[model samples]
Target: MPRPPASHMPIADALRARIKASEWQVGDKLPSRAHLAAEYDVNPMTIQRAVERLIIEGLLEGRAGSGTYVRTPRERLRMVRSRHRERRGGSPFRADMAEQGRRGTWESHSQARVPAPDGIAVRLGIAPGDPTVRTDYEFLADGMPVQLSTSWEPMAITDGTPIVLPEMGPLAGMGVVERMRSIGVVIDTAVEVPRPGRATQEEANLLGISVGDLLTHIERTYYDTDGRSVETADITVPDVRWEIAYEIGIEQPEQD
Candidate 1:
């Protein structure tokens, strides 16, 4: 006898509840689709869909030629970025890790005289093909890779200066704002735009995650009070393992 269609969402919810309640303990294989379909009086396709949703949600994991089993999620690292911390002119990653009694380290690679593309040139207020310093950074906390950043700064401003190369100067690791301040450039503002992205092969390789995993892409630009862009960066953080927090001061409008 054919059974009426059932919503897979409710089935997924029910399975998730059981998993959370430990009824289906970690490493326990979930029942087969045939059995679930018979028990719920639903189509086999519905059962399959419900299981797939649970797999994607990290409540269950499917093995090749084996049944799906409950999953034990890894511990996540939480990071906080705030204007108050920025005033201290330290690595935000290091500060956040220190709060949790963890250590953070990062390595950077730089190239000078790299030609800026059209988009970068516009943000930098320089002509297309203008030379700039480009640097790539990989940050790890507790020896686990957590973040990646690629930044560009126009050479016209830093040419013949001691900090032209980001990681090679006496001011190495001091941060862009501080380094620029040393060179008489006072950074007044920064803007960030965060968007959801899928991990690429390189990102997956560095972060040790599967390709196509969800990630957060943040485009950040620093500008001087004169409205000139001083630096720009593309920052990447994996969603499955990190929770990014931000703090800002909101001022209320003056009452009439």
Candidate 2:
């Protein structure tokens, strides 16, 4: 048997229904917490929780020093992941944003000679404590934070090379595929596993969303033609602001 719903769930549902029915139109300020609590015959804290739920759902928004109001729904941007994107030879995130008529920019920091952790070692097929280069990126569209990425590459493959640092050297900001190619490593495939999660304090602060909001965590890795893991990354995207789309290509059969 399933457990009973939380006390706040029903309140959140009722508020959502009213918004959907147009009882509260976009940009309309909601009733005060005390007023809502009086109407629902519950504590003000209960009403606050319900409002917070709606805020996280994108049905409502809170302005500091102002009040909670119905939100104007934002059109979700589609982030396409495909092999073709990797072959484009530049910043795929920028290209993706350009396709949507938005300017894409990112702030990244790279650190070299870091020891790989146990989990990252397994993904990169290297021993724990192996030297690697790590890069952290905050991706933005139209100046709004949209995604976060942490990438790792084994130092053995790139040590002493010009592309050793991801954001510097001759191939600065060229992305993994082109940067690797500059060093004679041909990347042939990438794998991604997406999982659902809730935002933590740090992620929420950086993303400008409430803590515990919905997020999609993608574990991605790029492999060379020889099946060696060359790069691995963990990417985080907020669900309310973006939708992830995947495009697949079919291979042709050998001609007789």
CA lDDT of each prediction against the hidden true structure:
0.85, 0.92
Weakest 10 consecutive residues of candidate 2 by summed lDDT: 1-10
Candidate 1 runs further than 4 Å off: 1-11, 32-53, 62-67, 250-256
Ten-residue segment with the worst summed lDDT in candidate 1? 84-93
Per-residue lDDT value at 182 in model 2? 91
Best by TM-score: 2
How displaced is residue 215 in candidate 1, in Å? 2.0
Q: Model 1 compared with the native: what TM-score?
A: 0.81
Against the true structure, what is every candidate's RMSD? 3.8, 3.3
| Residue 134 C-alpha lDDT in model 1 | 95
Candidate 1: lDDT of 130?
A: 94
Model 1 Cα lDDT, one tens digit per residue, 1-256: 7775678999988888888888988899988999988888889989998987776556778889998889887567676667666577756567767878989788899999999999888878889899999999998888989899999999989989999998887888878888899999998888888899988999989987656667989888999879999999999999878877878889899999
Residue-wise lDDT of candidate 2 within 7-50, one digit each (tens)?
99889999999999999999999999989887888777778889
